[model samples]
Target: MINRRDALRASGLATFGALALGAVDAGLTPAEATASGQLRGWTPLPDPAAGGVTSPPFPKNLTAEERRNLKTFDELDFTVFSSADWARLDESHAKHVRVHWPDGHYTDGIQKHIDDLAALFVWAPDTNIQVHPLRVAKGNLTAVTGVMRGTFSAPMPDGKGGYIEPTGRQYAINMATVGLWNRRGTMDEEFLFWDNQTFYSQIGL
Candidate 1:
């Protein structure tokens, strides 16, 4: 029988795909659109740091540093998210739950799905946002992936043309590489996570 978890997985993937198409339509290149695809699924790729290989260009006003990040990790594994970002992700989960034969925890709102994982994934509500990491599954042998929501294109603060706007591009990265989960299985080791932050300004917002 198709279980609740399976239903949720299918719904999340479909919804996230649709959301990704919407993002590309908003202004992302085919590559930017596919960046989210990498989160849900991974294939061996040519190194992103390779030369003459930039993703679709962003608005032309971001700072040298911001632009670099936009190119390097923008489409890298999405395992990063912020506090508000994660809360908003719950909104997506809530919506998909109804369509996917959700469990009582979702439909009845009894679960209060918000937690530190979700919270850390949200944007910092400031120009600079922290990219927090979370494991989608314990001891996952393969990979876990998901899509962050969409964001509007705005000029960046560093004299760039695009800003990594909050309330948008909320992250949806699941464990992809076995590297994160294999060695650590206990809660005590969770402290090993690294905190990476991305800062930017809105150019045209």
Candidate 2:
């Protein structure tokens, strides 16, 4: 299998080459990046666990409360959001669906989502997955907010967290690009779908 960094570099889109999540040195001139729009893309931020700044740009449009809400460490909850089929899970979608983190206390739907993806991994080992550095995208400010896609992979548990007991198993990477939003967060997963290897789309799932 191609290594994660190479695969991400190979992931073509608005994020190609250095624009795809990079390390922007502290105190570097913004002009160095402004000259290239690539500079505006998500830079490898300081790890939040170390208690540094969170989402520094704040997208310029979020309310103070919204911005403040962005500063917590909730990766497990956020990853579910990243991989969630939002139209089916997010009430915010055009067609609202119940949150796995449902309003009516603990629900089976929530547990099932975990069970389902875990089963999928066990059922299909050929599938390659990666979860990685999460980022957010700022749009028109008055409208939608965005989540950077993440990478998840094997030799690690894939969607296999949240089990209730000792048999709790992990089969995919614990690392994920699970970005939380002040509002609706997202997943910028660099995933590919294949149809017999001849016709397939390298999808950002």
Candidate 3:
């Protein structure tokens, strides 16, 4: 004795239940499955420890300035970008810092830079960046290259104050940043470069 709307609702719920069970079997939580979609045909890689492979230690023999810059960069990446700890912004940037992106847009103050970075999480809450193998520091400049990876699992803000719907697509794009640290041991300027076209294509935008 179900009406058409009731029958449709029941069918949708049954389908969702099946998908959730499948996601659980694939080692994903229900929430992850809801955000990341059904990861069909995906398999987790074997553990590296099983093959006697271990990660190497951090680089050594850096000058005092180089080491300090590296530490600051690591703090900025792990604390601010990856962990979303916005309060640590001052730890890496000066009060009047300027951040320039590849798109010719720039943020003037430390707070504005922090706000720009924070907005990314509104679109992709799980965004993370990892620097690998290419850290270099000399004098007042520090440069690092890494991959920024995230899933577009939330609405994105459009310029007109409306939001575009979530795409549920994940992306990993290579990016590089160069920072100029002042005598105060905080970056006074930073330049960031990344490919916007590749990002857009990967996110299905």
Candidate 4:
């Protein structure tokens, strides 16, 4: 069984990957994007020193698919921070969630999922992900795009026990995820894609 921590972590990676693709379309190399200190029309990456919420509040009116998509982001942005939030996953995800990441890695069950999330935070302590308004929702599928911005301050682990040294540079990249919901109205599987090379190249990893 996937633990609550794994489920939250897995969701964060998938969500970040899916939303990062938007950076590629913007014609900004991850380095170029962070160098400018903005993401063009998208919201500016939050200043870690100046603390404030960057993600918009969930809209009052939403389509079924949109609500589901928003739930995923909420889990990453809000619920994952607290142990109590694990219950939120039960309401929004299956016990046996499956995840696919951009690096062609796969994980099932919750414990593996939590491990991914832990690895990510370890590399970028102040990383932040937010949803953009542009979303597509149809039936059991929903796609939300956004940006992930953070400074690579510590050695990042490769999951194989190796680690990538931080370049001490910040990165802003586009991400997008297509979520598949089970019959229970929860996300069962997610397909995530982002420019790993772009991210690595930006951070000089």
Each model's lDDT: 0.28, 0.30, 0.69, 0.61
Ranking by lDDT: 3, 4, 2, 1
TM-score pick, better of 2 and 3: 3
TM-score of each: 0.22, 0.25, 0.70, 0.61
Q: For model 4, how does the per-residue alpha-carbon lDDT over 18-46 read when each residue is reduced to its tens digit?
A: 33344344332232445657654454556
Question: Where does candidate 3 clash, by residue pair?
Answer: none
Q: Which stretches of candidate 4 lie over 4 Å from their true place?
A: 1-69, 78-91, 158-163
Q: Tens digits of per-residue lDDT for model 3 on 1-205? A: 7342233234533432443354345443322333557555444534321232222223444568867987888777856779999888898899999887867677899889888988999999999875433455555666565667899999999979999999999988766676778888998878776778988999989
Give the lowest summed-lDDT range of ten residues in model 3.
Answer: 48-57
**Top TM-score hit:** 3
Please write out the lDDT profile of model 1 over residues 28-71, one tens digit for every residue: 33333254455332233443222222223353334454344333
Off by over 4 Å in 3: 1-61
The per-candidate count of clashes, in order, stands at: 24, 17, 0, 15
TM-score of 2: 0.25
Better of 1 and 2 by lDDT: 2
Worst 10-residue lDDT window for candidate 2 reads 196-205
Q: RMSD in angstroms, candidate 2?
A: 13.5
